[model samples]
Target: MSLTSRAATSLARQTGRQLAARPAASFQQHRNAANVAGNPNESHAHVTSPFTRGASGRQDTTVIPSFKRYRAGNEQGNKVFQYFMVGAFGGLTALGAKDTVQNFLVNMSASADVLAQAKVEVDLATIPEGKNVIIKWRGKPVFIRHRTADEIKDAENTDWQKLRDPQPDSDRVQKPEWLIMLGVCTHLGCVPIGEAGDFGGWFCPCHGSHYDISGRARKGPAPLNLEIPAYDFAEDNQVVIGT
Candidate 1:
């Protein structure tokens, strides 16, 4: 037969079989309803329905839930188990987040060996009196000036009370001859020229900021004195900068 004719015949046979099964199901439903009416106290397990018939024409057993089923003794225990499971999951998640944050902070921090090199050691023997030496420490220029006797005398004699950023020379320096300070001008972070200002100290040509021999901001727009870094005389001629 042709493909179209075969499909039509197959569809007709399936439709006929369905129509024949419907009447049998209706009859069974009517008979079951009559049996239930006749015996009102009949057991639910032996009840028959239009649907759910096995090969031997018996209905599958169905359990009807009562209100007491929900109130079973294990309900309280199940709730507690659920709460414990949620708490355990949350704790594990928090632990993972803490570990991630700790690892991130550790990666951002400097290593132990690098921290050990934080301080810079300078030999004072290489520097001469009446001259200034600029060295890099912690990525900033440090002014290490070995003052002459006349310069020290001049710094002490200068009226610190009249200066814009008032600071005594004795308080600024650790020792009389050695004057250590940062070379950066407080006005706009410009490096000042050493031994060249009006006061024979340091001059910032960028904004005409002047510093005295004692590293005091003596003139111009510079707001504060040259910053003094942390340093100590390790030996007779050796100094260590930074904590």
Candidate 2:
């Protein structure tokens, strides 16, 4: 045979051998992939996961697009936020209601100075001699009296035995007979009953307080004299309760 023909024959045999080995190599690669996928109990286990590249040039990486977890977490967070908003709104509404009720539903209160300004006028003809007329002045009870000769004599002649401070010469009273004083008791603010011709003063029923014709507290639980309201006689017989 010729030299070129022998070389061609050798090359042909090599090509045939390579063609037969190609299938065997592919089967071995597939067997390795199958073993990696199925055998979980293997000691040196190499998993053929979707996140890796295979030796056969196959793309094992898979882009799994699923919004299930995101949607579930978002729903749970939305529920929590909704509950928080509802609680906050309820608290604000309750506070607003309380403020409205406090501002508008309660009765208005007046000052003490306004109550102290009330005054009234009394008729001079109504008050008789040796008697007193009760009148309201500056939210307090006042007594206007027309003293008789007997009562005035009794008040002046008595030794002031019923008085707390026994100073007759000190001139607490402006008039000798005519007395105008507050009818309220000095201790606890009770109205005293005006008496005449005996003790010559007012007698309190609550605590048995006694006052002279000049409204000086003479006996009982009262601490001081009955208060005298500021007044001026408008005429010979007319008297005003307040200044």
Candidate 3:
């Protein structure tokens, strides 16, 4: 058979089947009506129709809601959890930004400190004779000396017992009493303590390093003498370090 002919025949068979079923359905409806009429005062129960109904037998529909129409309890909770998760992630990002800024500031401060240390400066008038004062030069501590007659004599004495390096030839201080040197200890950068008259010289308690009035390291574990900073005499009493 041709394809169009076969489709036509199948449709005809379906139509005939539906027509035959229609009569049986009508007969059953009629029988039910008759039975209902036989019983008088049967309290006519309401019946619902899909299409528009006449005033004789009309009833309201009872709607049943489908589960797919709304969210379940767990699904609602999941939405709330998603919102909280997003907020938590945002808070973490803010904290990370704060920490990054703080780290950058700390690095900048450290760089400034290094620069200050590379360039030291001082004034001569501030330091008195026979006494020493701590001055920041080139970002490091320096001892400026104002030698008295007695302290100058002590530097000249050069007694072997008092000094570890008596030669005074290979020392940081070029002069005996009127001296200037880096106050920082060469061993570990600790500033040495200088006694005006009682201790007689600079003493480092860190490693027992002793320095003369001229800031020359003489005794203890310190390997080298006190450093003489680069400086020049400004006037009669003025001095400038790291100029």
Candidate 4:
């Protein structure tokens, strides 16, 4: 071989060895860079999309905060609704209790009135003729008289048109022998004395009123006659004053 040809061959062999060493070194460097970048403690920025899933295959990290806010709002709303329900129920109960108390009071008042107006009884055989007997009934005085024949005749013969109240004798008595009336004067609610008036019926000293035997007001300031009590004859000698 010639000197020039040997020199060219040695140069080509050195170039091929260098090229092969460069490829191996470059591959090792790329592998080391990839390992360093994949380390967990490295300060590398992770770019994940908003719609991407997490490790548990659920929604992204933002979903957790949104769910917590929704739960809080629901809890607050539930508390407010509970308070409103309690207030409405209490108001209804109070109204019902008030109505019940008012009804009880009204019923008690009516019962008391009914008990106060109980019936009164009187025996006609105990009363003497030409005399008057005063009895108490319903917190007021009632006058019962066994009228004489002469008194009845005088009462029947009186002129009813000239009297102050103008009531006939026939309307004042259930029986001709008996005359019953209330003792209170029609003028000012004053009680009258029986058989002492100018007309021989009743006299009111407070108002200077007089009544006849038929309970008709004669010379008086009274505008009405003596009132006849509601009475019924249960037997011949017995009478019920109230019905």
State which candidate has the highest lDDT. 1
Off-target runs (Cα >4 Å) in candidate 2 are 1-119, 160-162, 166-177, 196-198
* Candidate 3 per-residue C-alpha lDDT over 107-202 given as tens digits, one digit per residue, 9 for 90 to 100: 777566566566544555666666767777656777777778786766666664455544452254444445777778878988777782234778
In candidate 4, list every pair of residues with a backbone clash.
Answer: none
Q: Residue by residue across 1-243, what tens digits does model 2's lDDT show? A: 899999999999999999999999999999988886786447244544444444543445474545576675567889999999999999999999999888775545545665466545566777678777777676677787788877677667767655685545225445554577787888899888877323667888888888877677777888888776776667666655564
Q: Over the stretch 31-124, how does candidate 4's per-residue lDDT look in tens digits?
A: 8888878873353336444544655444565553334544654778899999999999999999999999999988777466566666788899
Backbone-clash count (model 2): 1
lDDT of 4 at 208: 94
TM-scores for the candidates = 0.65, 0.46, 0.44, 0.57
Each prediction's whole-model lDDT (CA) = 0.89, 0.72, 0.68, 0.85
Off by over 4 Å in 1: 1-67, 111-117
Tens-digit lDDT track of model 1 for 127-179: 98888999988778999999999999999999889888889999888889999
Better of 1 and 3 by TM-score: 1
Q: Report the alpha-carbon TM-score of model 3 versus the true structure.
A: 0.44
State the lDDT at 93 in candidate 2. 100
Model 2: lDDT of residue 113: 69
Model 3 bad stretches (over 4 Å): 1-123, 159-177, 196-199
